[model samples]
Target chain A: MLYIKIADLKIRIENKYNYVRALCKDYIIDECEDYDISVSVSDKEIDDEISVAEVAVSRGYAEGVCVYRNICYQLPVKFNSYLLHSALIEYEGKGYAFAAKSGTGKSTHIAIWQRVFGDKVRIINGDKPIVRYLDGEFIAYGTPWCGKEGFAVNDSVPLRALCFIERSPTNSIERIPASDAVLRVFQQILTPRDAATLDALFPLLDKTLMQVPCYLLKCNMDDEAATVAYNGMNNDN
Target chain B: MKIKSGFVVREVAGQTIVVALGEATKIFNGMIRLNETGRIIWDMLSVGSEKADIVRRITEEYDIDEKTVQADVDAFINTLQGANILE
Candidate 1:
């Protein structure tokens, strides 16, 4: 059994298999007894998730089920949070989230910001980050299941802006209405497949949108694009 | 027919929007924005009211004639049906 602390919750992982333990190597901790939630992974458990037992015979499925069981499925519902598909970055101590469809160049755009600001910007999480409402404000938190790039930190910052990014020949930034922002954000977040979780997700999402400002960013992968987006977002606030 | 189970109507920033819930979200894709009258008619649908019931309630709620309310209700139902949101 391994105890990992993320998003202010102590999660206990009772994995009988070595794959999940190795996958969570960076997150392993010692000397923690009380746990907020406990998840277990085994060959039988994976077989139960899929109808064909043959399909569950792999290390990848074992590791994925563990994270999916804990981070993507259970934690969000329990904590009133959403796992947004975006590249989160911290700038000036405030978190900015850049979101788009897969291969829409969210990482490329954030790279431009890093090129321009050079060390002034830090990626909070490259792929999925938890956006939760706490202390009357919305915050972006990092988790162990940072997407393909493996870029995630065990930290959180106050959410400042959410930009729905799209690839364009020319760069432009437009402030969108809250209603439009809510719909766009709903698509970007990892929505649950059940009714109970969906009910919790809606009000939490609405409250987050009410507190944070949203924008639509159209830009190319150029240094000037970052400058334009940065200036437009900063000047407006 | 009845309105889908997972749809929730909400008012945000003075705009009335209908969001799809759970599995319904996969088919709807995005949210549906409704006007004041549309919101009223949608509320009636939520309670399993029929087309005639919607027309009557809409006519009573607004100053419009029954014929106009019927046409509006037909158009709204058509829109919902086209989106495949009605159960």
Candidate 2:
């Protein structure tokens, strides 16, 4: 059993493969008998993940995927946390998340930020980050399941805004109303398969949407895109 | 017409979102976002309301003309029907 801490929850994972352990090394903690939650995947679950995976995956990778999926599935009801499919970054001490459909250049946009802000910008989680509502603030935490870039840190940041990226020839961004943001945000979250968990998620999701500002960023791959995104979110525009 | 079973409706951020779950996933795997009027129509449909009855209810509730209400109701119902969410 490997004990790890993620999104401030202490969890015990019954891992069968070294790959999962190494993937989660940054979040590993000293052995402890007490944990907030425990997870273990059956062979069937690993097989299920492999079958649905976009590419071929080894048993170890599939095991890791199943464990993370199980953790995400439990987080909404167990803790006020859920997995968000976004590239989370910290700029000027506040977390900002760039979300879009797969192959939508979320990582590319954030990379532009890195070039513009230099060391002031840091990737919290390049792909999948856990968003937890803590004490009236929505926080973004890094996990091992970050995308192919392997950019992640064992840290958390208070999220300031979430931006949905869209490709366009012109660079523009605007603060979107909750009515417009909800469905876009919902599509990026790992929505629960059961009604009860989803019921618990709706309120948290609502609160997050109401409290945190959301933006629709229609931008091209230019240095100006990062500056425009930053200025718009900061109300400097 | 009625919404398919296993579809859960929730009001989030003052917007209505219908998500398919369990058996409903076998047909629809994504969520449907509805505006205020669409929500009203959806609620009526959940209870197996008829098309003419839904048109009447919306016209009465919103003080809208019957023709406009009928058109909106028809469009909304057509969308649901195309999505296979209405039975």
Candidate 3:
């Protein structure tokens, strides 16, 4: 069982499948041992718990045989697609993360910004970063969950804005009220089931919204939408 | 219970957490795991329209047998009732 803390929330990631550390169950619980992690092998199989334990490497991703509880899941020893289930990223940065339903082109719009702003911006987390409040300041951290580009960089930065993505004919970026922004981001966030941990999430979100601005970035997969999003974020008051 | 737009719905510890354009407050009790189809049913019910109107929409949209739809709808309604998240 591994204890992980974000904001004030405490979660335990227990590798219970086997020796390879291939299967993990993240629970929002103060007590770690009570949570259960189990898996039944499907087409892909790795001998036993020992193999699962061996696979739990310190700092890199791997393709392996694994399961998410009762559901049999496979992870490419090397994952390149959008980090879907296990990737968790968070940080404290100058800007908030952009979150949306899958296939919403969160990566594409981000590319537009990189092309337009170039040196003015930094790539904090490509996808599914964790955002939390530590002490009194919010922080974001990069997790194993790197989206399409498979760009995983473990770093933290100060958040400023959160942008929701959508492709629209007219390039427009509009501010979303703090209440709405918090809810949207919260939905996209990967949370476990600990009341204390869950409770911390909303408060941090509220705090982040109080200081940072959130917006809906609607535009074609063109630079104009990126421009509108940036301008809107900078202008958020 | 209350419903709102774009609420990120999550199942946490068998509890339903709704982040409805506000906070990630939750409604817990008997759980309803809204699958793709279930979510569609929930979306329809969320419109605040009459149950009969929702039934009409479901009949038009899904290929489900009417009896099955009614049963599913009733089961869903009972689940929500237990959770107190439904009107």
Candidate 4:
């Protein structure tokens, strides 16, 4: 039995199998005398290719949301662990959002900022972070989808900046205008709806874009590049 | 189908917002913005001019080192068409 804890989620898988499928009420869950939090796949979903298993685990007030693909991940992560979906790292903090796609090195950039800011920049969560307009202020928190890095922390902080990164051949940065950055910001946001919330989300996105200052950060993969980007943001304040 | 007019460009939050570029007034689902050159081509088209004359005016006003202003016109119109910014 392997159990991994991601953000506020505790994920455990039992019984070695080739594939992982979503769990439903009809699926069979059992208790092992040797292993606790053991979940087994019912014979039905194992054969169905399209089926998905969603396990609900809770930690403190934070709820666990998980989607599993293979049985290889039955073992738990060493650090605040979360499973990975794709080659991506997304986290959230307070009202401001900092999003970068896979190659953009989202974690590396944030890590550099964290070192510079020290305690001022709290990494509320790592991996897949959730953002919402709570109490009239936007809040970003960590989700369980954190990757193998296992740096998921249970914390929340006020967002101050939004950054978009690109792999550049040169070691220079460009400050983009809000209008030019808004299109990119809208494209990076992760939101879902059931026909009722999409319209609302766009406006929320628009309002958020209008308020935040976003930058186009072009840099190489080096410590100096991170310092340059962080200091540029710090100087504006 | 409407005849193309002139477009007015403005900057909002660092983005160049293009509206009513010349009188054509296309109800575009997606908006379009012209850089330095797009504005120049748009100016000649606004006065109910022909394509050939517009190209002549563009070649004279801009230092663009390219052959066939005709190709540029075709490409620009195609982009506008694809963006639904033209009738």
Candidate 5:
């Protein structure tokens, strides 16, 4: 049994699998005993303990390779948070996320940011990060199952911008309209198909979008692309 | 026809968004963004308002002619029907 904090939420997890435990080693905290949510992951057939949606997402996204990832998606909704399929990075002490389809080079774009900023930029999570509206601001946090690169830290940063990246001949960034931004952001999140859950989820999403500025970043895999994005977003607001 | 049971029209940052909820989300595909007039019509549709009632209300609210309001309402209703959002 281990207690850890992700997305500013305290959780205690009991796991029999070493792989799952190792994935969350960086997040383990010894000081906390009470948890808002507790998760147990095992191969044992515990029929009543699992959700149908959890099993569906396990097969759909992680392909059942990691039970832990499935839980990461499920638990956030209970706290009015959502897990987004994006690479979250901390730049200049603010959180910026890159979102796109699977093959849209989100990770590659992050690499370019690292190349440009070097020591100044830190990768919060390479893959999925949970986001929630907190105290009149949106915050992005790192989770254990970051991505294939396994780049994640148990940290939280105030979200500044969310960029939907696209490959293009020339580097450009534009502020998307709220309608367009809502659709794009909604598609990138792991949402449960339950009315009560969605009722809670949509308001959180709406507040996040209302607070955070979303951009459509069209760029290629080049160092110039990084500079272009940084300049454009900084000047946008 | 009535609007689907699980669809909610929410206004965020001055933009109106029609979102599908629960099992409706699986088949409703994506959300639709509407202008101020669209939001007004959606509100009426949700309450089982008919096409004639919508056209009458829009003509009364806006300075537009009855023919124009009817055309706009018809187009909007068609879009909702095409998306399979109306019952």
Candidate 6:
């Protein structure tokens, strides 16, 4: 059993492999007697993950994935937390999430922001981040299951903006209505498998969308793209 | 025809999203975003409303003509049928 804290929730994970522990080493704590959640995966669950994985994954990797999947599945119903598939960056003390389909250059775009803004940017989580609505505001937390780049921190920042990125020849961005943002945002979240969780998620999802400003960004791989995105999202109303 | 079981609808930020759960997930792994008219039609279908009844309800709600409403409802129903959402 590995005890870890993420998104302000202490979790106990029972795993069969050391790889799960190694992957989650950053978030691991010495011990927790009363964890908020406990997750354990069956052999069938691990095998199911292996079968559906895009590339060939080891049993250990599959186990780790299954554990995270279980965590994501329970977050919304058990807690007001949800997983978002995006590259999260903290800039000027606020978190900005860049979400897109796989291979959509979300990482590349955030890298441009890093170069353009220099030390002003920090990558919170390169791939998946746990977002929790706490104290009337959404906060993005770094998790161990970050993407291939392996960039993540066991820290969090208040979420300020959510951007849906698209590849384009010229750089452009616009603030989109929540109604327009819902479908796009849906594409970047883990849909709960059961009806009860799905039902419980709608109001939280709506509240998050209503609280956060969402943008549709079309840009090329240019430093100017980062500037445009920053200015568009950070504009003083 | 009626909407299949295990299909849930929820309104988020003024947009209606339909998602599949449980056994329905095997057939529809994605969500369907519905506009106002689509939501009306979907609600009617959920109650097992007939085609003429749906058309009448839509016509009573909107300022559109009967022929336009009929065509719109048919197109929406056909979309639902194509997605295997209605049974």
| All candidates: CA RMSD (Å) | 4.2, 2.1, 12.2, 13.0, 4.7, 1.5
Give the per-residue lDDT of model 6 (tens digit) for A103-141. 999999999999999978999999999999988999999
Candidate numbers, best DockQ first, in rank order = 6, 2, 5, 1, 4, 3
Model 3, A51-150: lDDT tens per residue? 5654454221222223322111111111111112212222223655777777777777677777876755556567655564546665565543455586
* Candidate that scores best on TM-score: 6
Local error of candidate 4 at A183, Å?
Answer: 1.7
Candidate 1 residues lying further than 4 Å off, grouped into runs, are A40-66, A73-77, A192-199, B4-34, B56-72, B82-87
Clashes of each: 0, 0, 37, 18, 0, 0
Local distance difference test values of all predictions, in order? 0.78, 0.91, 0.51, 0.48, 0.78, 0.92
Candidate 1, residue A217: the lDDT equals 94
Of the two candidates 1 and 4, the one with more favorable TM-score, higher being better, is: 1
Docking tier of model 5: it is acceptable
**On lDDT, who's better, 2 or 6?**
6
Q: Please say which candidate is ahead in DockQ: 4 or 6.
A: 6
How would you encode candidate 5's per-residue C-alpha lDDT over A1-237 as one tens digit per residue? Answer: 667777777777665545555667787777575677776645533332334434443322332234445455455467768888899999999899999988889999999999999978999999888887777778888888787787888888889998999899889999887667877887787654555656677777777777788899999998999999899789956
lDDT of candidate 1 at residue B13, scale 0 to 100:
55
- State in Å the error of residue A209, model 2: 1.6
Judge the docking of candidate 1 as incorrect, acceptable, medium or high.
acceptable
Question: In terms of TM-score, how similar is model 3 to the real structure?
Answer: 0.51
Docking quality class, candidate 2: medium
Higher-ranked by TM-score: 3 or 6: 6
Per-model TM-score on C-alpha atoms:
0.79, 0.92, 0.51, 0.47, 0.76, 0.95
Q: What is candidate 4's TM-score against the reference?
A: 0.47
